[model samples]
Target: MSQHQILNPADHAQLRIHTEAGAEFGDNVMASLAMPAEFREVQAHYPIVFRRDAETGKLAALALFGFEAGENLFLNGSTWEARYRPMAHAVQPFLIGRAAEEGAPPQVHVDMGHARVSATGEGMRVFDDTGTATPYLEAVANMLGDLDYSWHESDAFFTALETYELVEPFSLEVTLDNGSVQTLVGFQTIHEERLSALDGDALAALMAEGHLARIYMVLASLAQFGGLVARKNRRIALG
Candidate 1:
């Protein structure tokens, strides 16, 4: 029942950022550039700044570091790409203003794109395809024919969403299961989006009734259960 703490202001400053940690895929670790002081009175939020190889200091991802105008801001590393550069420029001013307030320098920043590095020394790879990326709970529900196994009923599947009151935005798709000949897209929550959706009202309500801890617990549980399994790339040897 522990409460979530907004990362402290000081901790953000001290982190050294890096895109490639080593030869291993997941070995690429990110850290602070040089910890900053607790100067800003406001709760400052800044995009992750990566340390560049050419220079010893931190470098901002190009997708997030400059100004263009009238565009969407790319926040997650997954969404950063050539297609998103224009959007990043649109919000450049706002980002710069925030960065200035935090006394953070800017470098070329970009989104990490939709990819995850395996802990093993494998190369970069996509985590999931559109057909099957739903969270485990939702996947199970869909695979087993709705949360209550009432797929035969008209509204059983849709009712699950209403019942869970999914507070977060998640991707769902219907696809074929290897053993079963059915296609289904199960529900999966987007962590960053869900966190962003928390408003002052929600926060106050959660904290007031000890439900805040429960919410976090549920999220953690979901994360552990909800992961996309990449079946294609996996190699299975049959004797």
Candidate 2:
């Protein structure tokens, strides 16, 4: 259960958030929601794919960390192996909340029940003694802002892909050195053939909206699959 509360210095003065990456802090996940704004950095570390919401039928991008659920290949001990973690994953235990009034600005809300919510005073303070937001809190706020904006804007990006039929079902079967096999399905990726076949006008529209570059980033990120498999193989060998 989540205990989300509006973050305020008065109410959360002594709250300290555990900043390390580990399963206890809910870091052991196969994937995270990816935003197009961060695709350039994400592409260098994780494979980007798309998944559709069963209820809304809306497409959302994901940055793959492993082939199976609860298996984060990039997680080693208490550290995240990747140099760049997707903002959605980085901004954990805190989320953007809106006010009851219409058009009110977003508020920072913290999950008091999260493991990262340090109960024994073992992590970074959210606010200083003077009730001022600490540098850590400031950074989290920025990440939340970026994530909120990018997530909403992602709808247009996905819509453009859908309109052009540029997405296709994707699946992968990995064979580890130990003869263990893993299969991944129910994902989608950019359809290179359809994208290439788009006429000049379609290309110009996508380029004008800056979706073309992001599309290419998703394509480029597929290369990281090999590295992901290598990480899995290493883990198996170690065991």
Question: Which has the greatest lDDT?
Answer: 2
Q: Give per-residue CA lDDT, model 2, range 1-239, as digits (tens).
A: 89999999889999999999899899999999999999999999999999999999889999999988999999998999989999988998999999999999999999999889998879999999999999999999999999999988988899999999999998899888999888999999999999999999999999999999999999999999999999999998999
Q: Provide backbone clash counts, one per model.
A: 34, 0
Off by over 4 Å in 1: 1-169, 172-184, 188-194, 225-239
Residue lDDT tens for model 1, 1-239: 22222222232222122223222212122211211111010002222211233564222221112111222122223333222222222211111111435655332221222122123434322212333322422332233322112212313212332233433334333232443222212223324454556679866754675444433443443321112112211211110
- What TM value does model 2 have? 0.98
What TM-score, computed on C-alpha atoms, does each candidate reach? 0.21, 0.98
How well does candidate 1 match the true structure in TM-score terms? 0.21
Q: What lDDT does model 2 reach?
A: 0.95
Best by TM-score: 2
